[model samples]
Target: MTFESPSASGLTRRGMLTGAAAIGAGSVGLATAPAAAAPLTARGYRTRVVLAGTAGGPPPQDGRLGICTVVLVEDRAYLVDLGPGAVTAYARAGLTMEQVQSVFITHLHSDHLAEVYNLFWLNYGAPGARGNISRSVGIYGPGPAGSVPQAPGAPVQQPEAPTPGLTDFLRGAVAATAYDLNTRMAESRKPDIWNVLDPHDIELPDIGASATNRAPDMEPFEVMDDGFVRVTAILVDHPPVFPSFAYRFDTADGSVVVSGDTAPSDNLVRLARGADLLVHEVYDHAYFATINPRLAETFSRTHTASDRVGQLASAAGVGTLALSHLVPAGVRDVPDQVWKRHARKSFGGTVVVGRDGDTIGIGGRTK
Candidate 1:
């Protein structure tokens, strides 16, 4: 049986109109009408977590590699993680770097954040390179906030300690790019070279930037002026690496949770509990066990096993479980049916194994 879409969650006509208004401000001058204007019953919002890179064990024929990128689209587009293949994947997904409003990093794992520099440069190089528009894209994630003092058991003194702390590691990169941006602007005689230009050479800044960058720490939690959607972020354990987060997105239509890279944790279960969709990272324990013991050990440390993922979804009673962050063993080999079988043994809900570009429409009846 198919699962009910989030639209089927029972949104009133007024609720739909409210959501539409929330996202409308950004739709000005668009070639096509905004998706939000579509009837809520017609599946107004579409969220896709495009697979940027998928690699573990032996490489695939396409030369892809380890847990990579994903882009989350709502009223505005937000990129979840930017692994190695993110740049290429973004292009493949038909997304221009300028269209992305903010980048929400799950954690600082190289595999997840590798493309940050690429995305930053892409945005920074846009026509209005030095303008507020270029600097408008916000990047949020967990990292050391300040100096680590030598005090014993001293609460690991991270000076600023914001929810998604800013680390110094990225400071140099931003500084290094200054000269290049200046050179490009001077040579082109254009201020916003990196931005997408209209026929008249006018740059189109991401409309969502103003609302999203206003409060970085309060992200996925604060509701935009549109009033149709709200996002909340909760800390989850992905230790050795402290402070990973699971994000929950609530809209007039329904709720969806993105379980960023993390081992099975109660925080995730609670974050996803009762949501219409749970997009989680899953690793193949059985396959890894046979391929390489060391790899298997690493998998255990970094991610949730398939069975454990299933259990979490079942325990949380999510409406649908979409497995993602796949490793080598082909997507079809993911034992999708097994998840359904076991989850049914427990939760008896719909289980979906996410494929690259697979779109799961929420908030509507199965047509």
Candidate 2:
């Protein structure tokens, strides 16, 4: 699907911020979506899943963005990653930024966090956001990414580092946007962006893992509870990127487990035990069987192979397994049948190669 990215003139951010109808019935960008999309179900389910993004990484693509998924529990929505085009995909899914109550980051890689600022930008800027989206939105995720030297003979640079935690990321994002905030604040009607979010650095257990450290034995910990749902975080292996996480959202009606990004993880399997749906990342090694060893090492190091994803889902007893964040995604032209066949090699459960706007209803709604 062709995405019509928003422009400053098309629908004024100022209009949206002031409660004016920033979008019309078929406004471009946020309103009129592409031809690739299908109609949403006429009857809404109590628990549903929206695959907002299915692309794997930083490389720009036409139809997909980086990994992002929105689990709609009843009427509330919670985000797993704010990848590039996240807000665009949300609007394309017939959802507004205001519906997002909290955001959960698996890890702080730029791919996963690309459009986060937009969330803060539009969520707080929308008219009446103060009263409706009034509460501090919860932002949850892993802590620092630990310092690592450039690969051997690489570029002349110091050890790499990312913000220490979600708190720091939010703080830094806000500070970076100070100019915009200050300018907007001149209007007495603006809501303070600082008060719009409640950032929590998920407390890592002393079993020990920090952004920089590794703790292989990941135990599940209940992190935060928005009135509608309770979220659980567990460590997963995305080595070199320590303290990576997989999250589970448990509501009264159903449950969904999101494997943020990882190699096969026992901790992820444990967390997804008896889940209604498992949204995971997958790469097809067969497509790159003879690629450079270094690139191969990178794939083996950070992502779960397609077959292993099936094994993990089957082991965890999830009712449905949906693969998002497809490495080399649709552009590579590896047919869906190929992916489905690869997954069937290991497990025998319902499997799907997820796409941008694909919606699935859990608690027994099948493909």
Give the root-mean-square deviation of each candidate in angstroms. Answer: 12.4, 8.6
Clashes of each: 25, 2
- What is candidate 2's lDDT per residue for 240-323, written digit by digit as tens? 676678999998768889998899989999999998889999888866666666676688878998877889988999877888
Best by TM-score: 2
In model 2, which regions exceed 4 Å deviation?
A: 1-42, 128-134, 153-163, 210-213, 290-293, 364-367
Report lDDT (CA) for all predictions: 0.52, 0.71
Which is the leading candidate under lDDT?
Answer: 2
TM-score, model 2 to reference: 0.82
Candidate 1: tens digits of C-alpha lDDT, residues 171-223:
54546776876786798553652342211111112323221221112223331
